[model samples]
Target: MNEQGEDTGIVLTEAQKRARRSRSIAIAVSLVALVVLFYVMTLVKGPMMLVRPL
Candidate 1:
């Protein structure tokens, strides 16, 4: 709210919008990479753990 105590919405500039988009894409890619890493780890450990003792 401004000095008048009126509620105002956010407005993003062109550069700000682009930066936000870039950050969003980077976050999405990082999330996907992490998921893939977990899947690979499960595949690599799943069978061996079943046969091997704790």
Candidate 2:
């Protein structure tokens, strides 16, 4: 038993584990994409991006 009173909290079922893993992977991918976007925005000169008022 854990301090929180959940004896099998760490023993997730296979399906649960797979779901969690996929969620984690998606989050990591999104973070990486955001970082790359930020880097490109900062590194690329203004002329490379087209801007128009909506």
Q: Give Cα-based local distance difference scores for all models.
A: 0.90, 0.85
Q: Which stretches of candidate 2 lie over 4 Å from their true place?
A: 1-6, 45-54
Q: For this target, which candidate reaches the highest lDDT against the unseen true structure?
A: 1
Q: List the residue pairs that clash in candidate 1.
A: none
Clashing residue pair totals per candidate (backbone < 3 A): 0, 0
lDDT of 2 by residue, 1-54 (tens): 777887764678899999999999999999999999988886784655566557
lDDT of 1 at 23: 100
lDDT digits (tens) for residues 1-54 of candidate 1:
878998777978999999999999999999999999988988989877467575
Report how far residue 21 has shifted in candidate 2, in Å. 0.1
Worst 10 residues of 1 by lDDT: 45-54
Q: What TM-score, over all chains together, does every model reach?
A: 0.71, 0.64
